[model samples]
Target chain A: MSDIYTNNYVIVAIFLILGVLLPVATVSFVGPLLRPKKPTREKQTTYESGNIPVGDSWVRFNVKYYIFALMFVIFDVETLFLYPWAVAYKELGLFALVEMVIFISLLIIGLIYAWRKKVLEWN
Target chain B: MNTLLQQAPSWGTTLWFIIAAVLLLAVVLGFVTYAIYFERKVIGWMQLRIGPNRVGPLGLLQTVADVAKLLLKEDVRPQHADKALFTLAPILAYAPAFAVLAVMPFSESIQFADLGIGLLYYIALSGITVLGVITAGWASNNKYSLIGGLRSAAQMISYEVPLVMSVVGIVLLTGSMNLEDIVKAQQDVWNIVPQFIGFAVFIIAAQAELNRTPFDLPEAESELVGGYHVEYSGFRFAMFMLAEYVYMFGMGALITILFLGGWLPIHPSLDFIPGIVWFILKFSLYVFLQFWIRATMPRLRVDQLMSFAWKVLLPVALFNILLTAVVVSYQNGMF
Candidate 1:
């Protein structure tokens, strides 16, 4: 059993390494071999609809994205909790069903809180 | 598959695994090539325009020609951009998109890693693509790219909730996270019937995940001008594009597995047609739906997209899980 688990993960690891190498090898080696290398200063400059860029493009973004990220972290973790319950649900029966209902309801309440706080509002 | 896994780690098996990975990669590249061709032809017919008849016979080789052009074009990088991250972003984006394919059960005997946690592995690995998107935007040192990346991050992460939640109903019904088990449970009937609502949520959330049509706020050409990939050129741009189509293939295969019953014929009487063909037919339906939507629907506004995901899809998905749980327990005479 342990051997299978380790082998499964080993296959995954091999795929991961191959995935990274495929693109990196193509771009660095094969791409440069065939692609042109003309890089004038004007051509290499930042694109701003034909106008010379005035300031750095890395400006501060809206705070709303941060709030969305925070909400995502909270909800994502909560979603992970559902997986375990779902896996064992058949064995747990009615008691598990009621417990999950309560758990989901509490999360719904948190969602409602965020909704009311206007954190979900894109603008 | 389990028998292969059971054997102690050996060089022979490892060699075979490497060969399989390479073969899968070639197959995916071919699929992406034709998918682009098919998308153009379908959309062109919808819009009353000729798609690509100039390349090979009936434009079958158009993607090949386009790929060649991309390979031969100048590779550009902005002087002010973060060199290391900029170079790494496309690899980051494309890798996970391909990596997740390892868990997808293409057919009964055609899967790679038949991990016990197949579903979770797919969702988790696919999520990493969002990080690559953000990195591409931030590294480019371009405002539009940054906004596009941020929009994608927000859209994908938000919709991911409903996407996962929608699948919970199926997981609950099957009582297993294994893709093969999920499909086997649907041997009598596809999950789409009992889990129709979850199916709807999954379709919508998946479109958003793929950044297709209505949910393509990240790369909205009008607003963000190619989104986070605006700064990329030549083969780098091709990598991002490859990632999108490969992900489409992955997502289409997943939808087939989860809802339509992976490799299972519509009717058992049609079983003589072969399982791989059924899998391809179902997978084609999803890929076609994506292009049809792309040609027909307009993109959603950022605010509207967020509200739709959180307010509508998420609640509906939760309700689906609750409904499925209730029905399951009732069926089992637990009530």
Candidate 2:
């Protein structure tokens, strides 16, 4: 059983390496060989319609995205906890169901808080 | 495949895995190639146009020729772009998209990885692609690209919560995260019957996760101007496109496994047919639905997208979990 477990991960690791290698070989190596390299000044400018781009794009912008990320982290962590309990629900019985109910209700509370606080709003 | 896994760790097993991975990669590539072709043909037919009939017969090779054109074009990099991230972004995006397939059980014997946490593995790895999108936007030094990247990131993150929650009911019912177990759990009746709400939330969130139409505000060409990959060209751009289509394939297979009973025949009498054929048929239905919806639906407003995920889908998904738990426990004689 454990052999099957370890082997499952080993295959995944191999697939990961091959995944990266396939694109790198094709996009970086095989691609550059066939593609042109002419680099005029105008060709290298940041594309923003026909107009020349003004200033840098990496400027500090919206804080709303940060709020959304915060909410996602909270919910995502809560969801992760729910997974294990879920998988073991059949063995753990009604007691586990009750516990998960409290847990998920707590999550619902957090979501409701975010909604009430307007953290989920995108203006 | 299970037999090989049951054996002790050996060089032979690893070698077989590599060969399988390579073959699966080719299969995924073939699926993507045709998916794009069919998406165009399907959408074009909807729009009253012929759509790429100039390529190979019935426009079969249109995507191939387009890929060739993209490959041979100039590999452009803006002068002020962060050279490293610009180059690395595509690999990061494409790798995880492909890597998630490691856990995808195509047919029982054809599965590559049988990770215990197969479902979670897919969701977790797929999340990494969002980083690459954000990185490409920040690295591009283009204003539109940054906004598009951030918009897509927000959209993805918003939908991800519901997407993950939507599957909790399936895990609760099957009592295992291994996708094979989930499929087997549905041997009687598919999860779609009991878990219809999950199926609905999942399919909707999945559409948003893939950044397809209705949720395609990130790449609204009318505004963001080609989204995060605005500055990418040649094979680099192709990598991003490849990642999208490959992810579509992954999502389709996942939906089939979770709701459509993986490779199970609709009825026991139909067991004479191969499991893989049923798997492909169900998988094709999903892929075709994606194209059909893309042709039919318009893009949702950005605010509408965000609010819908949080206010509507999240609560509905949470309710689904509670509902599934109640039903499953009652059936298990725990009520």
* Clash pairs for candidate 1: none
Q: Assess candidate 1 and give its TM-score to the true structure.
A: 0.98
Candidate 1 shows a clash count of 0
Q: For candidate 2, write residues B68-127 as lDDT tens digits.
A: 999899988999999999989999899999999999887878787888899999999999
Each prediction's fraction of true contacts recovered: 0.73, 0.92
In model 1, how large is the Cα lDDT of residue B48? Answer: 99
Which lDDT value does model 1 have at A36? 82
**Where does model 1 sit among the CAPRI classes?**
medium
**Under CAPRI classification, how is model 2 graded?**
high
Residue B164 lDDT in model 2? 99
Candidate maximizing DockQ: 2
Task: Summing lDDT over every window of 10 consecutive residues in candidate 1 chain B, give the lowest-scoring window.
Answer: B1-10
